[model samples]
Target: MSQLQDNFGRRFHYLRMSVTDVCNFKCSYCLPDGYHPTGKQHFLSLSEIENLVSAFSQVGTQKIRITGGEPTLRKDFTDIVRIVSDNPSIHTVATTTNGYRLAQHAKEWFDAGLRRINVSVDSLDPKMFYQITGENKFDEVMRGIDAALTAGFERVKVNAVLLKGMNDKDLPRFLNWIKNTPIDLRFIELMETGLGRDYFQAHHLAGADIKAQLQSQGWSLDIADIDDGPAQNFSHPDYRGRIGLIMPYAKNFCATCNRLRVSAKGKLHLCLFTESGLELRDLLQHPDQQAELIERLHAQLAQKKETHYLHQGITGVTQHLASIGG
Candidate 1:
C-alpha cells in the first residue's frame, strides 16, 4: 500500500487516536464547565478500535498517540494501549494524560506496551495549578511524574498551556524543576476554541516570546523527527531536561503536518480544527472493511486545508479542546 500522503506531498505517519471524550479536569481553557454527556454516549468498542488501528497501520501509520478528554477514564485503557503497541507496524505508542492516575497505573500501562508518556502539568505551584485545572492534585501529579520515571519511561514530557495571568509567572519554577529532572517540558500557546473564545481573549500568550527567551539563555533548536508533533524542541547542555515550544500561530505552521486525528466516536478528522469529520464508524464494523477504511482515509486527506483558520479567529466546530481530544 502507498503511504498516507496528501496532495501537498506531506506523508502522515502519526495517528492521534482518542478513546474517550470524557475528561475529569476542568481546565479554564478547555472544559471549565466540566464534561457533560450529550445524547446517549456511544464510544467505539475495543474490536472497532482494533480494526481502525489495523487499517491505519496498514496505511503507513507508525506512531500511535492515544489521546482523550482523559483516556485513562476508561476501564479498558490499558487494553487499548496493548492492542496498538502489539501491532508490528507501530514503532511507538504514547499517551497524554492529566497524571491523576499515573501514580497508580503508570507501571501497568508501561507493562501493557506503552513506551512514551506526556503528562499535563500546567503549573508547578500547587495553588496556581488548582486555579487553572480546578483540581487540587498538584502534589499527587508530581508524584505521578516520579512514578512514570520509575515505571521505566525513559523521558516523560509535561505539557502546559500558556495562560496570560494564570501560571504565567511559574516558568522559573518549571525551569528549576527540569534543571535536574530530565523531563521534556513543553509550553503550548493558548488557542482560541469555540468554547474558550472569551477565555482565550483574556489569556492568550504567544509561545514565540518564550522561545526567544530560551534561545537567549543558551538553548538551541533541535531538528524534529518525521513523526514528531508541532513542538519546536530545544536543548541546553547545562540543563538535564529539554524545553519545547508549540506555536500554532507561527507562519507555515501546517507545512510540517504529519499526523491525523480519529475521534472516539469513529470520525476521522483530517485536521484538528476542521469544521466537519468524516463518519468512519460505518466502515469500522468488521475486519473486512480495512481496505475500504484506508480508501476513505485517503479520500478525506484531499479535504484537509493547507492550514487551520485559527489565525483569523475561526475555531471550526471545536467547542473545546476536550471535544476532539485536542
Candidate 2:
C-alpha cells in the first residue's frame, strides 16, 4: 500500500469526510443566518461514499471522521457508520454531530458500529447556549449527551469554539462540570473564514492562554495516538474528564498534520484554507475506479503545502465552518 505523505514528510492516516453541507445550527460564529439552500444540494450518495472510503482505506487510512453541517441529518447515517466501520483497515470510525439526535439515535449509531463521537456544545449555560447556537435545545442536547453515555460510548467528546468575550470566561464552569463526566471537552480557537471576518475579529481568543491556565492548575498533557485529531489533550488525576485545546494559530501547528478533508461534494481539500479543491466525484462512480482515485489522491498529496497561510489572512474558498464541516 502506498503511504499518504506530503513533500514535507507529513503522513496522513486520518480522513475527515463531509457527508453534507446543510447544517441546521445557526451558530453566531459559523452560520449566524441559518442554512439556506442555494441550489440542488447534490451531496455524495451512499454508494459513492462506500467507494470513497474503500479507496482511502486501501491507501493507509486508519481512521475516518465523518463530518457535516450535522452528519446525523442524513437518513442513511447509521448505514454510513456501518459501512465505514466494516473496513478492517480502518480501526476507528467516528462522527461529529450537533447532539440533537443523540438522545434518540445514539444506541442505533453505536449498534451500527460507530465507536467514537464528538458533539458541539458551545456553552453549558442554557441561555448562553441558545445565544451562541441560535437554538434553544440546550436541555435536549444535554439529554442527548446522557443518552450517548448510556449507549456505552466511552470516547465521547464535546467541542466548544472559544470566543474572546463570549464563552472564554466560561472555562471554570466547563472545568467544574466535566470533573466527573468522563468526557473530553475541547476548546477550539476561532479561525477567520470568509463569512466570519468581522465576527472573528471581535471574538477570536488565544488558545495558548487557556493552555497556560490549564498547566498552572496542574492539568498535564496526555499522550496522543498516531491518528488522533489536532487537539492537544490534557488530564488531571482528580478529574474523570479531560481537556483539549486546538490552537491553529500557534507556531508549527501543521507539522503533525495527519488528516485530509473531502467535502460533501467530493472535493478534496489539502488544507482547511486551501485556495480550491480537487474534484473527485467522477472517480467515485464505480468501485473499479479505486486505483485511479487513490492515484489522484496520492498525486495531490505530494503538492500539499508546508503549512496553511491563515496568519496572512487568506481563508481561501471556505466561507464558513458549516460549508466544509469545520
Candidate 3:
C-alpha cells in the first residue's frame, strides 16, 4: 500500500488513539472540575479499536500512541496496548498518562508490549500538584515514575506543561530530580485550548522564556538528534537525561506534522486545532466499508489546515484536551 500523505506532502506515520475519555484527575487545563465521561456504549469496543488500528496500519501508520483523559482508567487498557503492538506495521506502541495508577500497572503494560511511557508531572511540590490537578496523589505519581523506570521501558518521559506563575518556577526542581535518572523531561508550552481560556490567559508561558531561564542558570544545552513527535529535544552537559520543548506557539512545527488523532468516540481529527472531523466509529462496525472510510480519512487529511492560528488569538477547536485525547 502507498504511504499516506497530506496535501502539504507530510507523510503520516503516527496515530494517537484515545481509548477512553474518563479521567480521575481534574487537571486545571485539561478537563473541567465537573467533567463527566461519555456513556460506556459511546466508547469503541475492543474489537472496534483493533479493527481501526489494523486499518491505520494498512495505511502506513508505523507508530501508535495511546492516550486518554486517563488511559489507565479503562479496564481494557492493556488489551488495547496489546492489540496495537501486535500489528506488524506498528514499530512503536507508547502511552501518555497522568501517572496516578502507573505504579500498579507499569510492569503489566511493559509486558503487554508498551515501548515507552510519558507521565504528566507538572509540579514536584505536593501542594502545587494538588492545586493543578485537584488531586492529592503527588506521592503516588512519583512512585509511578519510579515504577516506570524500574519496568525498564525503552524510554520514560516526564511531561510538564509550563504555565506562567504556576509550575514554571519548578524547572530547577525537575532538573534536580532527573539529574541522576535517564527519564527525559519535557516542558510543553501552554496551549490556548478553549476549555481553559481563563486559565490560559492568566498563565500561558512561551517555550523561549523557559529556554532562556535554563540557559541563564548555567545549563549548557545542545540539540539532541532524537525527534519523537513535535518536541525539540536538548541534552544537558551535567544531566543524564535530556530536556525537550514542545513549543506550539513560539515555534510551530506544523509544517512537518505527521500524526493524526482518533478520539475515544471515534472522530478522526486531522489536526489538534481543527473544529471538524470525520466520524469513524460506524465504519469500524462494518468491515466492508473500511475502504470507503480510509478514502474519506485521506480526503480529510488533505484538507487539514496548513497551520493553527492559536498565536493569533484563535481558540482551539475541541473544548478540552481530554476530548481531543491530549
RMSD of each: 0.8, 0.8, 1.9
**Superposed model 2: Cα runs more than 4 Å off:** none
Q: How far is candidate 2 from the true structure (C-alpha RMSD, Å)?
A: 0.8
* Model 1 agreement with the true structure over 1-326: per-residue lDDT tens digits: 88898889899999999999999999988888899989877998999999998999998999999999999999999999999999999999999999999999999999999999999999988898999999999999999999999999956999999999987898889998899988999999999877777788899999999988899999999999878999999999989999999999999899999999999898988888866688999999999989988898888888788889788778888877786778
TM-score of 2: 0.98
TM-score for each model: 0.99, 0.98, 0.94
lDDT of candidate 2 over 119-213, digit per residue (tens): 99999889889999999999999999899899998599999999988788799999998898889999999999988888899999999999999
> What TM-score quantifies how close candidate 3 is to the native fold?
0.94
Where is model 3 poorest over a 10-residue stretch in terms of lDDT? 219-228
Q: Which candidate do you rate higher for TM-score, 1 or 3?
A: 1
- Candidate 3 C-alpha lDDT tens digits along 1-326: 56778777888888999988888888888864846856554788898898899889888898899998788988889899999989888989999999988999999999999988999988999999999889899999999999999999999999998889888789878888878889889999988877678888899888988778777866665653322588777777788888888898864568768789998889998888866668888889866777877787777777888888777888756778888687
Off by over 4 Å in 1: none
For model 3, what is the C-alpha lDDT against the true structure?
Answer: 0.84
Q: Candidate 1 at 321: error in angstroms?
A: 1.0
lDDT of each: 0.91, 0.91, 0.84
